[model samples]
Target: MSKYLFKSRLTPDGMKGLLSEGAKARREAVGRMVEDLGGRVEAMYWAFGDEDVYVTAELPGNTSAAAMGMVVSSVGGVRTTTVVLLSADEIDEAVRQEVHYRPPGG
Candidate 1:
């Protein structure tokens, strides 16, 4: 499984729906959504910013992550951005991979 950070901005309809739902109800709904994606929501928060909600979760893979993001965004009630989170070991492994590249004007 891989970790991810999900940032979401509520659409007008989403905002209205949130206003009508209680905090517990929202949490339950989010939990169910993550379960449906075969993932677990580790943390979630409602924030005051360009993005309304932030979520941390562990999903099966990139495909699962993309699928979840697509489904949520298609609802027209929220726009989401999913970023894959890597651990220190993963970063170290990535750093070992070689790629042909050059700096600008090098």
Candidate 2:
């Protein structure tokens, strides 16, 4: 499984739904959506900023993540930006691999 961080902003319609449904209900709904995709929600938070919600989840893979994002956005109530999360060890492994590259003016 791969982890992902989803930053979401609710549209005017979404905000109305949230106000009607309540925060907990919305969170639970998000959790259920993730579970339906063979994933689990790790953490979720409501924030005040460019994004209204932040959700960390473990998903089956990139394709699943993309599908989830697409479905949510297509609803027209929310917009999402997904970031693939990697563990420290994953970064260590990444740095261990190398590629040849040239700077613009090297």
Candidate 3:
């Protein structure tokens, strides 16, 4: 399993639905969605900004995360951006690996 951060902006219909349903219902709905995707929501936040919600979750893999994003976006109720989270150890290990690369136009 891998951790992911999902950020989203609710569409007009999505916002209306959320307002009508209330917070607890929204959370439950999110929980159900995560379960359906074979993932777990670790944390969720509703915010006041360009993005309406931020979610942290554990997903089976990139495909699962991408599929969830696609479904949510296709609903016309939300737009999502999913990012894979890497651990500190993962970054350290990456630093130890050797690769040949050059900056574009360098």
Candidate achieving the largest TM-score: 2
Better structure of 1 and 2 per lDDT = 2
How many residue pairs clash per model? Answer: 0, 0, 0
Give the Å error, residue 86, model 3. Answer: 0.9
| Candidate 3: residue 21 Cα off by (Å) | 0.9
Q: Cα RMSD to native, each candidate?
A: 1.4, 1.0, 1.3
lDDT for position 64 in model 1: 89
lDDT of 2 by residue, 13-99 (tens): 999999999999998999999999999999999999999999999999999999999999999999999999999999999999997
Model 2 quality (TM-score): 0.95
Q: Model 3 over residues 60-94: C-alpha lDDT tens digits?
A: 99998999899889989889999899999989999
* lDDT of model 1, residue 32: 90
Q: Which ten residues in a row have the lowest lDDT in candidate 3?
A: 22-31
lDDT of each: 0.90, 0.97, 0.91
Which numbered prediction scores highest in lDDT against the true structure?
A: 2
* Reference-based lDDT, residue 55, model 2: 98
